[model samples]
Target: MPFVTVMAREAPVLVVVTWEKTVSASQTTTQKAIADEVNPGQWKVLKPRKGLQMIDFARLWQFRELLGMLALRDVKVRYKQTALGAAWAIIQPVTMMVVMSLFFGRFAKMNEQVGAVPYPIFLYAALLPWTFFASSVTASTNSMVVNSRMLTKIFFPRLIVPFAATGTPLVDYAMAFIVLLALMVWYSVSLSWQLLLLPALVALTIISAMGVGLILAAVTVRFRDFRYLVPFMIQVWFFITPVIYPNKMVPENWQWLIQLNPMCGIIEAFRASVLGTAINWSSLGMSTVVAVVGMAIGLLYFNQAQRKFADVI
Candidate 1:
């Protein structure tokens, strides 16, 4: 401390000032503080880790609230200023159903193959799951890239980004699901025990979508070409997934190949349950197997890929 005198408007004022004496002393003080905190019992550095078991991200569990917040943020940002807002969800699937109803059901007489179920109702049922799956994949395909800054800066689970992307679409799916119910009632469709399986079927869709999305999310970090590939893939996937025409319309020999698409089982089962049609156990089982397999593979690769995300990002 030092005493100083100043003239304030011709009146003398006395003040005391305190100052750090030397940069060396300041450095010594900081070193002491750090040394005190660095005791073996006091602090330790934790390197990032991935769990050996799939779906066993313990650190991510600690941040579940963060996952919900990120999902909510995306939901708000997604339709913030849209003209129709969430109605866009209803519009996309409903429009596709109408176009298919006109061109295939009415013009081409495709409804007869699905056996007693109306084409519009048939189409909308499958649309619910497909739309959910497709949009989830699309979001995941870009999730890592879009949140590159957060990925680089944050310590949360890498899976949470793609996992969070899956949530916003469910809001859209729920909105679209209401339309499906109206169509079911309009078409005089009846519910049955099969409807009980709807939740299980939806779970499969989420798992499958997340599985595929994880792969795409990991890849999108490295390959920019996926943007174009995604649209083309979605087009091809839609045509093959029995969205417009019933899976029954596909030749019997080709059914096995189509079953290779994990969605084949989910959408078909979804349609059958919604329309009270006879269940196809083989297709459903194949799809379940593929979904689990796809999930395991995606998790394997994603875990390996995530190690480099922050570095490349």
Candidate 2:
């Protein structure tokens, strides 16, 4: 059979291969004819086509060291020259707790709104997930711009930018969780076996954040309008979520409607897992579905948009 060669050219081309046909005439037709048939498929004389890669998850996996470095970089840059450092994480949520404790818990009289749970602890439980979500979303949205140099110069999985950006919040999450532990102790709440599910809860929040972040990162590279929209969206999202009050405050019949917001389920799950509140299975199920759908859509768009980021940015 005649040998075949296939050339892959992205730009100015040099002959990547040259091959000689040694087989007899009865074994195959003319070399050119065989090359046409075999070059793109099996029996290629040159090495097999690796082809353009898709997703490059192995590339992402190989870039774990880079991801860790970026994550650490985020944490350092966040607290650098700031007197409070990591304390700021607790400060924001604690202040929010105080405001809600005064307005919602005291004046609005929502102490018994949810259940027998104390208002402060109830609010704090919800705060943990919300804080992580908000911080992660903001950071991930800006990740591409922040790492523009690397994106243009290197060949790592672009998804790592947003994924790595989320790590700082996860660090803050751990520290704030310490405070949560103390609060649980102070409030005399017992830890349940379900608290072990914290990792899973965090995974869901991260996935959800990445889903939103990838979409925003892609758009931000082109529109630049997304930079402004992020903060506004966070503020609006805060009010819409039951961070200060309980979802139970909403009518029972409409509970499913409220859970349509994916964060609602995450927040509810965090509260239930930590504070031993009742779990809303339906809300949890719905939120999981929404998050998964959002992630799939985000990945698809991010992959599509990634090709143009270097060009646009």
Candidate 3:
């Protein structure tokens, strides 16, 4: 019989393995052989990250499968056992279009601002993106608290939970977009080359939602009151975002201030793209800058706060 001692070092930590051989004399193995068996691959040393580490994109990419699975789970759970199921997606924007058309277009005469475009179509186009953004933000804001059990039990990117929360709303967005196309056909709205910019606009909307959602999600872990505040914040955000009315309705002197709200330019550009109106390049550019800045800030703050999440949540 022989004894073998294998040692493996991983930065600030070291592991030692002790084994007693029961093999026959002809089948003897060396300490190096035992060490090779104990550490066959590169060690994955996970130490507590210091303040505000750069986002580990490689690590996130490795967890891509988990991200997809979490996103799929969210979509399934959202409509599970529901009567209308996905139809609620179409119904919500359509219902909102009707109400806004009656009050804003017919009574308040906001339709006049849109020129040739039909009020319902104009309203619904903006509603399409706004609905998606609102739903995503609300879901992402509460995501941390909703998945507290998983956070405590597992080890994965904390950012993935909020990021996955954004996916379920995109399902609703796609369904609602069908109704927008039908409305465009009914109103004889012609598609322009600007329609090609839609994918970019959708990305901008997601970035904006993710930016705000990350901040709120991180905060909600420490302050449960944020769960209640999220809905009201979204409602107020809807009004300031130029959803029901045209952006031009806001006076030129104050338009710059409105453009500071990232959704303002996104919704306005989305409506313009669908209705074949001239796109506001300046406002859209401003919005792009603002959205990118917000996302950077959100990521920094979320990363800094995530370390305390499991403890407080």
Candidate 4:
């Protein structure tokens, strides 16, 4: 009989022979046979280095079904007893567009600078992505705290909680995007091939939002100050993100600085991609780099902090 035992550092093989008198092979042959039984190749090999920390990517992959269930749970629970139900998604963005168009577009006379597009549609285009980002950040930041019972009870990836929370906003974004489509039709705005860039733009938008959400979710669990800061930061963030104004008004010299703000590019990309306007390639490229860098940092920080969450939270 032969068997293999796998440890954090290595795998070793063992064998037992029933009849010692009939030992047909030397100890070397027995060891080799055991090694071959353990692994078809080299089972007796040793590694001088310490074992690596297994990230368990496959475990996360196996839990994809759980992830979907959790995301569905969030969406169902969000609008459970609300009067309008999911209509709130459409209502909120549309309402904001009207108010902003009136205040910034009419009252402030910024409408003149908004170019050929009607102010309402322009503002709606920007709001769509901003709203998604804001909602995702808020939900993700509080995900761990809200699911403490599950965190303590279940043996799943903690990151799944924040990832699931972020998913509901994506559904809201899709509903809002439909509204945007209707508005485009109402305005008689013609769609061009440029509109095809939306999927990529939307992908970038989610990555950027999730990157920020990941950082916030981890930090908020420890400091708790981030819970309050999320809304306040989003308020300031919206103003700086050119949600109500064109990046064209940002000045040529300052455009470089503005492009460095990841959302600046994301918003500009969304508007250009959906509205069939000129693509701001420089800004979009800058934003892509910024978003990717932020994601890397966020992932590293979140993974590093994940181990401490159970102890701290």
lDDT of 3 at 16: 15
Question: What are the per-residue Cα lDDT tens digits for candidate 2 across 191-276?
Answer: 89879878988999988888898899889988878999999999899877888877767788887678778899888888999987
Clash pairs, candidate 2, are none
Off by over 4 Å in 2: 1-53
lDDT of 3 by residue, 268-297 (tens): 899889988899999999999999999998
lDDT of each: 0.80, 0.79, 0.83, 0.79
List model 4 lDDT by residue over 41-65, tens digit each: 2222234423323344544665778
The all-Cα superposition gives candidate 3 an RMSD in Å to the true structure of 6.9
Ranking by TM-score: 3, 4, 1, 2
Question: Cα lDDT of model 3 overall?
Answer: 0.83
RMSD of 1: 14.1
Ten-residue region with minimum lDDT total, candidate 3? 16-25
Best by lDDT: 3
The TM-score values for the models, in the order shown, are 0.82, 0.81, 0.87, 0.83
